[model samples]
Each structure stands twice: as C-alpha cells, then as structure tokens.
Target: MKKLVKLIAILALVSLSQISVAGDPVEKKSEMKMDHAMGTMDESKMMEHLKIRQEEMLKMHDLSNKILAETDPNKKQALKDQQLELIKAEHIQMMSMHHPKMMKMDK
Candidate 1:
C-alpha cells in the first residue's frame, strides 16, 4: 500500500508535466485549463481517472491536429467546426475529471 501510493504520486507528477509540455497553442490552452481544474486532487484515487482521460485526450488532440494540419480550405473549415465540439468536451472533461475550475463564462 505504501509503495503503491508513492508510485501513484510520482506518476501524477509526471503526467502533469507531460500534459504541460506537449501541446501547441490551442492544445496548450486546453492543457492549462485541465491543470487548473485538477486543483488539489487526491493523489491516490485520481491516478486511474487521470490516466484514462489523458489517453483519451491524446487521441482527440491528435485527430484534431491532423485535420487542422491539412491544406484544404473547405475541409479545414469543416473540421474546425467539428473539432470545436471536441474542444468543449475536453474542457468539460477537464472540469468533471478533477474540479469545476476549467469552465469559464462567455461575455
């Protein structure tokens, strides 16, 4: 139990670092929102949910990045609109995963 707890603590720290470093401008904002929302989670229990969400986000971001990187204008616009929902979902997941700190109101 003691060793497991220590391992989770270490992983939580590393995941936080990876999530911070591995993103572009838009993705970076998502990362920041997630980190901010994570707030002060319980290190032990949060590990499972954190790992699952991180994997899911990586897939989502990768798909969005690939679509955005395409050179076609029409398709780009279409993909952008589609991915917009994904971005919102990402923010929601960030909030629900840890804390409600990620959401902000529109002006």
Candidate 2:
C-alpha cells in the first residue's frame, strides 16, 4: 500500500513536469486549468475518501498476511471471516464514493 501511494505520487510529478515543458501557450493554459480543477475537486472530497480507503486496504492486507501465517484452523477461519466482512464493506464504500453525480461534479 505504501509502494502504491509512492508510485501514484511519482506518476503525478512526472506528468506535471511534462506539462511545464509544453511550448504551446493555449495548451499549457488549458492544462493548468484542468489540473487546478482536479486538485480542487480532490481536496474537497475525493482525497479524504481515498485516504480512508488506503488505510482500510492496508488493514486488509495485514489481516491477509496474518491469516496465511496462522497454524490453528479455527483461528485462521476467524481471520478469513473478518477479512471477508472488511472486503464487503470496502466494496460498498467504493461504490458509494463513485456514484454518477459525484463523478459528474468532478468532471
């Protein structure tokens, strides 16, 4: 999960650097506007949700690792069940965050 976050940040930086290199004035202006709008939208709503999702995913990953390493069958089953519930909740949360109205507002 940390690696995934790092990769996304790296990609964002690379893309922004490329934008600065563009020579076309109109293209740069439009790109800047688009970037600003996206940043604003993310800061307002999506970024907070993403942070929560990232933390949840990290917890799920840790639970998975614990499940794999456990020797007792009963304990393992309990961990598996917990992980399944976490997954179901995560799915419902992601779906709600991505509703059409929210997405349309971002665009």
Candidate 3:
C-alpha cells in the first residue's frame, strides 16, 4: 500500500509539471484556426507559382521516365516509385495553393 501511494504521487507530480511547462491550449487552437489570407495574392501571382511548379514537375517526370528506360528492371521499378512520389507532391501543392493549412504557431 505504501509503494502504491508513492507511485500515485509521482505520477500526479509529473502530470502537473508537464501542464505548466506546455503553456496555453487556447493559443494552440487559435493558431490552427487561423487560415492563410489569400486576399493579397492576385491571379497572376497565383499563375506564376503554378507555372513554375508545373514546369519543375514536368522536368522531374521526364527524368524519371529516362531512368525507367534503362535495361535493369530493378532500376526501372525504383524510378517508377519515385515518379509516383513526385506526382503526389505536385497534387498536394496544387491543393494547398487554394486551401492552405494554418500554421501551428502561438496566437
């Protein structure tokens, strides 16, 4: 019974200390709620970002294709996997431009 009581006391102290050190939870939530203000970004600015990214992705896809053209089957498969990842990143970036994720920062 004494050992159990000591363990409980230690756990309680650890939890309390962590809470004090972590600071405010409300500030964290507000940071997530805050969205990117796209009001300042004009159409041409958006187009420019998109255009540059599209060109880069195209170049990477071409490079990946060239890698897959090799006679080695293993190298071809690896190149294909890398190509998929580049495509996924491109899609994610495209989506983020319209609906950007909020920064996880102190409010």
Candidate 4:
C-alpha cells in the first residue's frame, strides 16, 4: 500500500512538471497574435525585396554577357568597371532599405 502511494505521488509530480514545461497559455496566445501581424507585413516587404533583387540580377547578367563578348581590352575593362559600380549601388540600396540610419552615416 505504501509502495502504491509512492508510485502515484511520483506519477502526479511527473504530470505536473510536464504541464509547467508547456508554458503560459496567455503569453503564447499573445505571441501568436503578434507573429500573425508581423508575418503579413514581412510578406509584402519580402516580395518587394525579391523583385528588386531580380532586376539587379538581370542587369548584372546582361552586363556579364556584354563584358565576355567585348573583344577590345579597354571596352572590356570599362564594362567590368560599370558592373562593379552597379554592385556598389545595389549594396547601398539594400543597406538603405534595412538600415536607413547606417546609410546616412555612410554619406
């Protein structure tokens, strides 16, 4: 009878510990609500970011092809320089989007 009581007590403690580990339901609900709100905003921003990235990638691809096709060394070097400038401009644009304050510091 004593062993049976001890076993039941241990089982109850284990079950109670599992419930505590589950965490606060109210906090979890609030977090879920916040996540849902932010997710919508982030989705739109993410799509816009992807569109900008696509444009930059297409421009870079075209420039790379032009650079490869050019036979004159001076013209090829000019194309390469142009490509470098494009990359720098893209970096600045991305930084401005994510860190507008940092962009001001760059100037």
Q: Compare the candidates by lDDT and give the number of the best one.
A: 4
CA lDDT, candidate 4, residue 23: 24
lDDT of 4 by residue, 1-107 (tens): 65674465345333322111112233422222224444544565556545544554556667767876899999999988986666555454445545779989979
Q: Which residue pairs collide in model 1, if any? A: none
Cα distance off (Å), candidate 1, residue 35: 18
The per-residue C-alpha lDDT of model 3 at residue 86 equals 53
CA error at residue 107 for candidate 2, angstroms: 31
Q: Kindly list the per-residue Cα lDDT of model 3 for residues 12-97, writing each as its tens digit.
A: 33332211111223342222322356445456655654455445545564654466466888888787676555555544433443
lDDT string, candidate 2, 1-107, tens digits: 85775565445333322121112233422322324444554353455434544555556567767877899999999998876666554443333333647756756
Count of clashes, each model: 0, 0, 0, 0
Winner of 2 and 4 under lDDT: 4
Model 2 stretches with alpha carbons more than 4 Å out: 1-40, 96-107
Q: For model 1, what is the error of residue 41's alpha carbon versus the real structure, in angstroms, after optimal superposition?
A: 5.7
**Ranked candidates, highest lDDT first:** 4, 1, 2, 3
Runs off by more than 4 Å, candidate 4: 1-49
Which number leads on TM-score? 4
